[model samples]
Target chain A: MNFKMSVVVRTVADIMIIPIIVFGIYLILHGHLTPGGGFQGGAVIASATALLIVAWGTLKDNKDDFSTMESTGLTMFFLLALLGIIMGFSLFYNSLAGTGGIFGGTVSGINPGYINTGGTVPLMNIVVGLEVVAALSLILYMMAKRSDALEVEE
Target chain B: MLYYILQVLVLIGLVSTAVAVIWFKDLISAAIALGASSLILALQFYLLRAPDVAIAEAAVGAALTTAILIFAIKSTDRTEGYK
Candidate 1:
């Protein structure tokens, strides 16, 4: 990769990725009431990560690390979802709201319109986000590694 | 309202991109086009008020799927010329 071109493309791509990640975060945080949530925001964030990888190449070469991250993230996500079930709520159910808080909030509590009160939803979001990021990073790393091995062979 | 229009446009875009992916010769370019199609579908999901599904689709469908496809293509023999 030419230094100047790499720098410029990397910088440009990085600049573009930041806002998308921020927007993804916003969606995740405000998911209770809006049209965005953990999965969508997480995916958006993952795309940003993908963009980074495309722009900057693989950040590391330890395939085992990526695999570990993927497994851990997946386990955490499942466990969080399980928490809702163990609490007597349906799987992936949003059951962490009471009945009253901030006016017009999006919380799942007693308050009808609050956005910040979902008990397990936010936690679920975090878990899913982590899983998504880890899964994506691992996949990309593996792909790059495979390509590198092929290049060596050829 | 405007939302419906946006949703329709997104759906159209998604379908068109899917077609483009199918028609494109280069595997990598096709995979990228497929990602774009998935992103458009995600947008449609948002429009349809299912953000969670949308997000999952975008991540798994667009990002993960495309990467896996690219990897698979890279490892396989490149078939000369398109059918």
Candidate 2:
């Protein structure tokens, strides 16, 4: 059962997919300094996934992988939040802020944004982005697969 | 002045798209119209200084939701006005 769109759509999708994914990553990484955060960036990446799915119309889905990644992302997120408590701060505290660690620094004034200035915010953004991307992509893949099955049966 | 004009235009587009979504009898057409509405809404969000929301809305509402609805229509009837 071959399921694929015509050549034009597939070509366009192939061309656009990488840029879309890159933009999503940009949103996630700069979330603390920028307008977009984890959820928005993840949605953007998942939209890329949707584009690929729609254009190809079929996929060899590794459902286990997506679910595993989703779980890992959520666990890592909570672990980070819990680590703050272990580090003598409250849960969800900015443990890394002003500590000269990765994603650690304090912005003094209104200026051009630095990527590593948000402490735990960037980390949280990344984890949430990962979870969202994995979950939404999995949903789209499952739905596409199910619809394909229904068509075959009909 | 330009910002206000753009906002007004987007709002008009948004309302018309919303109407089109309800007016279309073909499920796929309606789905596409919904996507258009979502896109316009995203534009409005950006105009309102909320790029985060605009990105989310464009991705989820315009793209993924449209894809999901289209696939759903594939598994069911394409048109909606029939008995």
lDDT of 1: 0.70
Q: Predicted candidate 1: interface RMSD?
A: 3.1
lDDT string, candidate 2, A8-65, tens digits: 9999999999999999999999898888899999999998888888788776767999
Q: Which 10 residues in a row give candidate 1 chain B its minimum summed lDDT? A: B74-83
Candidate 2 has a DockQ of 0.69
> Which tens-of-lDDT digit does each residue in A1-154 have in candidate 1?
1112378888998799879889888877777666667667767777776677666765556567757766776788788677668889777764555523432224334554455566666666666666666666666666755654665553
Interface RMSD of each: 3.1, 1.8
lDDT of each: 0.70, 0.89
Which ranges of candidate 2 are over 4 A from the true structure? Answer: A151-154
State each candidate's clash count: 17, 0
CAPRI-style docking class of model 1 based on DockQ: acceptable
Tens-digit per-residue lDDT, B51-76, candidate 2: 88998998899988998898888877
Real interface contacts reproduced by model 1, as a fraction: 0.60
Model 2, residue A95: C-alpha shift (Å): 1.6
